[model samples]
Each structure stands twice: as structure tokens, then as C-alpha cells.
Target: MGNYRFILSGGGTGGHIYPAIAIANELKRRYPDAEFLFVGAKDKMEMEKVPNAGYEIEGLWISGLQRKLTWKNMMFPLKLISSLIKAGKIVRRFKPDVAIGTGGFASGPLLQRATKKGVPCLLQEQNSYAGITNKLLADKAKRICVAYDNMEKFFPKEKIVKTGNPVRADLVNLICSKEEALTFFGLDPAKKTVLILGGSLGARRINQLVESKLDFFATHDVQLLWQCGKLYLTDYEKYDSNTVKVKAFLNRMDYAYTAADFIISRAGAGSVSELCLVGKPVVFIPSPNVAEDHQTKNAEALVARDAALMIKEKELDSEFEAKFSGLMKSVQDQERLGGNMKKMALPKATEQIVDEIEKLLK
Candidate 1:
């Protein structure tokens, strides 16, 4: 156990990448002398993000099967073969004691190879519904750590551990006090602030809703920190008024969360976990564009519990204003939403995950 060696594989999207890194960071903190390696899809976001996170990474030539029947399907077999060969080589060379998979095509071949090497492989599943890669690796996974409960439906009951997903360290650590957060974002300390996030890539539908409702926000004296993602429809300054601040990405999410009185966002699992930590009154506008329509399912799981509110991506353009405005008008209702959400927070997910990894090694 003192000679700890670990491998982590996940990513294609930030949802998978960030959690994988969060788990890795925790493990590193626990075992500072441990050797760590990341296996990720070639040319994907993880290729860049993993390196930026200060870890060594090996890339596998893997991508998800295209949803539609297309020429891309023809390349799947070749990519599968190439990825397996690459994955096997990486596993054999690193000789990891334990392997962790978050979710993504890259994780499939890598974890499969690790299992073949008789390494202890643990799978961390972030969604309420299991992902395709996690499903494929289920039989090989020695332990399964999941964010949602009742996942015996997805994995062997014996392997399931109801450990929550690892959220970003910076997020769980409040970076700014309320007054500092208010001034940093240029929001009025006296006025309630609304934060709008649409993932790191941004959601077109959510961005459009905010664009149309700028004047409506001013009417309420509500300040906004709108994360428009990269698909900024128009110059942010063009849409800028006294009440709205629009940016492609919000690097200082902690401050945004601190200043926000209410929030609107797509219900990607990572964001959901972070919100549970922040516990702000939120209106989740789940993106219908995701694989398996999982975002909607994630939002519904919370909305059904009366912990949060949800709107459809299709309905966001139509219903967001009416619903959000109604919620914002009621201070008591807002407090209730915030309090219920806070009750759901698994602030120790990172610590719990690290403990599990330590137990596995022991």
C-alpha cells in the first residue's frame, strides 16, 4: 500500500473530466508518493485538460459510436482495436494497483485492460442513470462508487457503493465572502443576484432566454452573471445593460455562486453536485441535447423530491421567465428551495472517495 500506483480514465466532456480530476487530486493528497497516470481519448478535451491538471496522461484512440447510422460507424471497429492495443500497452507499462473510471469511451478500453491485468478497478458513476462506458465496465469493476442511490438496477448489488460524486475543491471552498462576491461581480449588494450557467460549452436555448429577458430583469432590479458559453450570439457588450454581465465562461464560479441569490442552469451531473454544495435557489433547465437525455433525468430526480425546480430545454425559451420570475418574487419560497438543496449536499464526497481508494489499496 505504501508503494501506491494508480490509473484514472475518463473524459470527452467536462462532466466526466472534472470529476475524474477531482478524484485524482484527492488520492494524490492522501498518497503524495503515489504514482498517477490518466488514460483519455486522443484529441479530446481530456488530452488538454488532463495535462493542464498536472498529471501524466496516455491517449487511447477511442470515440463513442455515432448515434446515427453513418460512415463513422464503419470506423468503430478499427478504433476499438487500436484503443485496446494502446490501452493494454499503457496498463502493462504502468502496472497500476488500482484503476478508476469516471465515464467516457476512453475509460472502457482502459479499465477493461486494467481488469485483465488483475488490477483493482473502481468505477465512479456520476449520473443517476448509468452511462454506456460504465455499463460495459460493470462486470470487471471490483467496486462501483455512485452519486445516486438504488443503482443496483445498473450494477451488481454487491459492487454498488452509495458514495457521492467528487465535486471541485475550489467550489466547495468558498473563495469570497458575500460582500466581496457582490462587489467582484459588480452586482448591487442590496439587490438579489441571479446566476445563469449553461455548462462550460454553454446552452444555446438558455442563452437565448436570458438575451430576451434582459429588460425584464432590470424591472426587478435583479443582477445577473450570465455564462453565455462560446456561442455568444452577439457581442456581450452589445447586450450589456446595467443589470447584466455576460461572459463565454465563468472562471471564478465560486464568486458567482457566492453572489447569486438564485441560479438557472442545465442539469449536467457535475453542475447538479456543485449546486447541492452551494445550495442556492435554482431553476434547472436541462439540455435535451445530451446523450440518453440524461440531463433531464438528472433534473427530474431532484425536482421530484421538491429539492429544486426544473424546466425543459424546449420550454426554457418559453417558460423560464414566467417560472423564474414567479420564484424570485417569493423570498420564503426561495429560502425553502435553498435549504432543501443544502440538505442534499455531499460535501465530503472527495474525502469519502479517497478513503475508499485507500481501503482498496490496503
Candidate 2:
């Protein structure tokens, strides 16, 4: 095999960025001599995150169009034109063997340019509902790798592949023991740990719910290992004590997953996939603010299988405490839910996606 060159374009959120990173890491493992280039939107998190993950990345001048007509929305066409030109230049210079897109606005221009240059492109859609960009690019994609089934509703049936979403390597098979994980987080071994995740930017409703329920959690003799995200960390930090450990982010997710007896998380596709692999009983509080309300649909998929529990944002105030209390009181229910969730995990997702890329390379 020759030294292959690969281009990955995705970003705007961790859901998109992390999957692209995972795929790159797997591809690198298979072809150590291979060169990788990442393209993401300028001023987005991927510019910093992809570099931190040890890769070179180029930024395109692009942003998603806002729903309301505003100054940013007015500039959308100009940005798209600029990004397409820049993306075309990058593709011409890079001459990649294959281009992989993990579903983001940046990937739209880059993959479109790559396809125009006769480069094979693979699109990975993490959500049950396909992204607008992926749907638009589906016609030219050599393959559409997805986490959810029924993607034929969005992409060409012949091109769709259910390879699942790629999660962080550390989360796949947690080597850290529960004891070790507890120590890593400085969490109490005596109390049952309830790990709370509100996404990287934090969810305001989730934060408010957690804050209101602190006393209830204390009463149940459960300790909180909360990742409230950076935006709300300052506001939530004052409540941190022996029972509640609040963090802006959980850099060591392996430890966080291992230490928890149960989890409360937002229902982002990346989070759902990671939680399934972790095999813990989880309560999903999906953000209603997301495009297409896809988060709710993601959670519902798990709930329908009896693999996890979900409380919609609108129902959280009325249903959360009762649902949580019921879950807390039933040890049998926890084990059953955890076992079922594990059965749904596609642990080898990254490897499978790379396998498709390898085929394209040949």
C-alpha cells in the first residue's frame, strides 16, 4: 500500500468534531505513513480541538445560516461562496485519496469541492435524523455511514451504510476500574454516583433542573459527578461540596463513566453512542433547542428499546422527580436497563468506518 492522503471535514460541535477525530485516529493506526488534513469552519472549536488531538487543520470561512433574517444570515451566501473557493483550492493542492465528512456546515463546501475533483467522499451522519448538509451532498457521496437505521429516507439506499457513530477510544473499553475512577474524580466510594452531562456548552434547563434537585439527590444518598459545561460552571460551582463535584468539563470521560452507577445526560448522538458503550443506566434529557428536535428522537430510539429512560424538556418539571425516584429505588431496573443498552452498542464503529475508507483507497 502506498502512503495515502486523507482529508476530513467536520466541526461546529463536539458531536461532529469527535467522530471525525476518531475516524482519523483509526485511519492513522491502519496507515501510520498516511497524511491527514482536517478542514473546519473558521472560529469554530475544531480549529483548536483538532490541533490539540495532534493534527493539522485548515479553516474555511463558513457558518450555518440563521433562521431569522439578520446580519449573519445576510452574509451566508458570501461565506458559502468564499468557503467553496477556498475548499476547491485545498482539494486541488491536497489531492486526497478520500474525503470523509462527519456532518457539519464546513464539510458541505469541502466535500462538495472534493467530489467535483473526482475524490470519493464518505459522509457520517450521527443523528437518527439526517443533517441538511449531508442530505444535500448524499447524491455524490460514495458511501453514507450512519449510526441510525432508516437513513435511506435521506440518502440514496445503495450508498447508505449503518456503521454507527465513532466514539472516543478511551470510552470504548474502559480500562479504569470503579475504584480507580472514583479516585480520579475525588468522588466518594460510599454513595452511588450519578454522573450528569449537559453537553460541552451546557444546557440551561438541565443545569436549572440539577440545581433544583440537589437536595433530592442528597436525600437519596447519591453523590453527583456533574459536568455542567463551561458556560454554567461559574454559576454551579458554589454548590460543589463533598457530595457534589461540579466541573466545567470532564476531560477524563473514562473515569467519569466508570465511577457512575447511573448517568443523566443530554441526548446528543455522540453522547448516546458513548453511553451505550459504557452500558450504564441513563436518563436522557434532550435539548429542545436543537435543529429538527433530533435530540428528542435520539433519546426516544433508546427508550423504545427499553434500553434507557427519557424526559422531554417540556415534561421535565412535571415528570423528572417521579421518574428519577422510581429509577433510584429499583436496583433490578438499573441492571436491566444497563444490560439492554450494552446490547445496542456498536463498539467497532471506528474500525468499520476506516474499513470503508480503505476500500475507497484501493
Candidate 3:
């Protein structure tokens, strides 16, 4: 293994941070002696997570611009200037062979400075619709790794590489049986299991839907394994019982996937990739709060291929019961969705992304 130095930057949410960690882990596996440095926004999740993953990280005084006029929006220019200066110093001091970005506010300045220094850079765009950070850096990126097809509209066609998004390596192959998973979660094996996920921080609407529909699940003989996320755990944990298991986060996602017969999830790109590998019937309620309504676009890509079903948040109040009831009752629909999702699984995404990184190193 070559003892090369590398820099990675991404943050704000688990969708961005986890992919960066996954790529770092893959590179570590291949080059045990290589040095890795992570750059992320100072107050974001990545500051804590990167260190937990066993890598040293530096934080930039940066944040995304607010959509409305606010104090934070006013500070964007100053923050960008400060981050750019710090990123340049970090790049010069680290002297990384290659810099990689998984989309986030911090990556914009980090990659921009790296490119100016004549360093090779690669960008991993997780969403079907590219984020502003990735779009702005596309011209200078030596290779653009992507999870979805036809990313030519976002990045240069020649540089685009459909390597897919990196997900947790442990989740790529699950060996837990349904019965074991049911026992682990203390649910009845006879009942259909539905896993609810609204990303790591949780979704308010999803939590409210589950709250109102607790009886709906019980009457239908379906067990609920709800990940309420950290944001709303206190508000919803009181409803947890034998039939419904509510948690702030799921540490053993492999076991959760094994227990689930069906899934209700937000359509973040990383979640979509993991769900595809898990091969379960999924109903995506793409969070309407994301950039460019990208979560909806991500879910649509699968829905178009008949790999999954989608229920927009706006229509959920009127249409959720009918759509959800139909899905739960039909074994044929469940099998078809699961089969199609499995076909779209890219289990080797982490390896493939590392392969692209290696190419740039060469």
C-alpha cells in the first residue's frame, strides 16, 4: 500500500457525513498506512463523527446560506472568505495527493482551494439532483463519482463516473433471518413488520403520521419498528410498546433491515442506496424540505423503474391511508417492489468509489 496523504470534506447531515466516512474506511482498508484528514463545518455533525470513525479532522467556520434574509444569510460572505483561507492553509500544510468531496457547504471552499493548488480532486455527488457545492466544483473536479445515471446534465460528461454512493459496509450483506430479527426487536413473527425511517434527525410529519396511525398498524396486524430520530424521540417515545418500537437512532441497521418486511422512509440518496441493498418493499415519503426537492427526484428515479412507491408529503394527509393500505395487503406488490429494488442495488459502491480515487492517485 502506498503511503499517500488524502483530504476529505463533507458534513451538515448524516447523508453527507456517512458517505465520507465510508469512503475513508475503504481507502484505509486498501492502504493501511495512508494518512487521512477530514474537513467539515465547525458546528456540524461531522466534527464529532469523523473523530469517532478514528480520523483527525479540522473544522471550518462555515455554513450554508439561508433561503430567507437572516443574520446567518448576511454572514455567508465572511464565513466563505474565512473558510477559504483556512482551507488553503490546510491544503498547503497537509500536502494531500488528492482531495475528495461528498456534497456539503464545507466542501465548496476545501475543493476550490485544493484545485487552485494544482492538486487532483474528485467529487461524489449523492443526490440524483446535484447540490450547488458539487455543481460549482464540477469544472475543476478531475473525476466526478455519482450514484445516479445521466449526471452529464450536472457535471462534465467526460469526468462523470457512475460509481454509486458509499454505504455502511456491514449493511452490504445481511445474514440475520426474519425470525431472529423479530425476536431481537421483541415483535411477533406472525405480524407484518414495517420499518419507519425519517433520516437521522427525524421528520415531524412522519412522526405525526405514525402517532395518528398507531391504531391503524395494530388493527392491520402489522408491527412497527419506528426510528423517530433524535429530534423527536422525547415526544414520541411514550407510544412505544410490544407492537411498536420507537427509537432515536438505529445502531444495528442490518438487524432492522432483516426485521422489516416493508419500509417507510425519506428519500435521501444514502438511504435509497442502503434500502436497495436490503431489498425490501419501500414507500418513500421524500422530505419536501431538501434542496431542489432532490429527495423527491431521488425517489422518482426508483418509482419510474417500478422499484418503489412514493407518497408526497403534501398528499399524505388525504392519500396516505389508501396508498399504504393497498401496499400492506398485496403480497404480489411487495414482492415486485423488493425484486426491482434488489436489481438496482450496487453493493460494491464503496469499493468502486475507492477505485476512482486510486485512479486519480495514479
lDDT for model 1, on a 0 to 1 scale?
Answer: 0.86
Give the TM-score of each candidate.
Answer: 0.96, 0.97, 0.98
Number of clashing residue pairs, candidate 2: 0
**lDDT: worst 10-residue window of model 3:** 175-184
Candidate 2 has an lDDT of 0.93
**Residue 88 displacement in candidate 2 (angstroms):** 1.1
Tens-digit lDDT string for candidate 3 (201-309): 8999999999998888888899899999999999999988989999999988988999998899999999999999988899999999988999999999999999999
Higher-lDDT candidate of 1 and 3? 3
Residue range with the least summed lDDT across 10 consecutive positions in model 2: 353-362
lDDT of 3 at 167: 83
Clash pairs, candidate 1, are none
Stretches of candidate 1 exceeding 4 Å from the true structure: none
lDDT of 3 at 95: 97
